[model samples]
Target: MTTAPVILDRAAIDAMIGVIEGRGHRVVGPVVRSGAVVLGDLSSTADLPVGISDEQTPGRYRLTARDDEALFGYVVGPSSAKPFLHATGVPVWQGERTADGSFATRKPEAPTPVAFIGIRPCDLAAIGIQDKVFLNGYRDGVYGDRREGVFSVVVNCVEPGGTCFCTSMGTGPRASKGYDIAVTEVIDDEEHWFLAEPGSDAGQEVLAQLGAAPASDDERVRVENLLVDAADRMGRGLDTEGLPEAIKASMESPRWDEIAKRCMACANCTLVCPTCFCATVEDETDLAGLEAQRVRRWDSCFNEEFSYIHGGSLRPSTYARYRQWLTHKLSTWVDQFGEMGCVGCGRCITWCPVGIDITVEAAALAAAAKEATHV
Candidate 1:
């Protein structure tokens, strides 16, 4: 059966949080942290980043005050849902020497269930990509349990950031799937409410607890119109018609050298990216070698040592590293996973010190391929 949309006022939102917490899950949502809006623990509706909007461009991010008290006024910030699900510096196992020169090992305890609110549509897509990475084929039990236990509340975009390209990626402006509950915030001179729809049985139960009234047809139409406006306002776009093939054919394109000149290879892009899931494991032991632990920490392809082998590093040049990163994200990933690795969140563009835009580089590659064909 199709679930009816519900209208949630400010008070109802607060009640919704309380109701979720009552179900033994810690509620996390967007909050003003330092100078940006980031996901944090929510004790009440007051913890949300109300009336704050973020301005994002290539190599820039800043928070601005919104004219209205709209709770979900901002797009994404530096953080995504990755840290909660695929955490860094996590201990995989610990070992201790026994009396007879043997070792004992044990895995860490399971993580707590998390209820995430105000997750952007792009981020929701990112989580889906990671699900394939960790939960497909061999399947990572740790990541799977945490991810499966999440109660996600996706907030569709009404105001996209300057670097946003989710619309072009077919990931967002408005969420289509992978959320327990989705909401669109509407605030005007006369009304301030959210048109909420449940995507799962759990979401339906939570809404039932809030006792939120069903939304009218006019309210739903208003939300659809606003989403359309948001899609049209996207700051960037990528033509993905033959993107994977074009990127693969541009293996020797001079564009790599051009991009490498400005590339720092500092791994900031990979570090901030929600879907780049490369990691390295390290084993540590005490001076006496009595106790030791194996830790799995996040790694990046931009690092020189990441490609080190017996003789030397495979990708010794900056151009080679940059090419590898972009090619894998846009081209090779599709071959491996049957989906592109990027969701067009543009965190890499906003956080890069040199402000390198992936969409621009991808477009340039496609253009170069087209010119070559003509010649």
Candidate 2:
């Protein structure tokens, strides 16, 4: 049965982790590493990035200390649920030479189920977008295997980063869906706790195990005010009304050439992006030629060889590659996946070497399209 809104004290976090572990899930959450908050194994609430916050802008990201001892005070760092769900360097299949002159091939076993904690709402949206990419058409066995029975706990964003624009993309500062449980952290002069609500049967059971108490009306109002403030504080926004059509129409815009001058084609944006799921596979054999394995690795459209076929690379120029990447992300992705590829997590803007903001580029293309329409 769906439970009422509950209040979980600071100690309840540790209890929640223990319960998830008790269920045989490898618990992972946000932790401090290399001076940044990234997803890692969680043994207790102490392992979380408590009292830490992040400063993110175009081409920069830094970890800073927060005034309060809020356990989840920081925004998302470079990592997301992507690496865990769609793992890289996975062996698709291995083949061995049999005694007689034949080859025996076998697919790799499915991965163990995992429980994710402290997931941001934008990342939850990103996971949904990836679900469409990997689970819809052919049903990728590897991603499907990893995605099964995975428990997700989403943490609402009450303090968005400088580069974040989830609100503009209709993703969030609040967890709308795709979570087993949702939490909103509250820290003030009086108390520090979480307002938790179950989104699924498993979540209700977990909260019951924690003995979470029913939340009061005051607590609910406080959380609503915090979330509304956070929404107003979003650092950037993209006007997506006619964005896809504008991007598709601006194929010949000179704005691409301007961006190409600073574009490094380093693929850092795709690597950090939660939804850019282009990948390529390779077959390798041992020196003895007795065994062979096919490996699937993440790829990027910015690479010159990515569009290469037998004859030559289709998009050799940096401008053409950039155009292709943006077009696919905002315009063509809707045609392919029924939605935009980006969830507005802002990882690309924060991690780009030259600070090439996708939102700015898209606006430029839209303006160019409007000017052309008037002519």
In terms of lDDT, which candidate is strongest?
2
Q: How well does model 1 score by local distance difference test? A: 0.90
Residue 187 lDDT in model 2? 93
Q: Model 2, residue 332: what's the lDDT?
A: 98
TM-score of each: 0.98, 0.98
**What digit string (tens of lDDT, one per residue) describes model 2 on residues 273-334?**
99999888999999999999999889999888899999999999989988998999999999
lDDT of each: 0.90, 0.91
Summarize candidate 1's per-residue lDDT along 1-375 as a digit string, tens digits: 358999999898898888888888879999988998888999887899888888999999999998889999988888899888888888888889999999999878877789998999999999999999999887886677678678998999998889999998899998898888899999988889999999988999999888788998999999999999999999889889999999988999999999999999999999888899888889999999999998888888988889999999999999999999999999999999999999889999999988999999999999999888789
Q: Pick the candidate with the highest TM-score.
A: 2
Candidate 1 wrongly placed segments (more than 4 Å): none
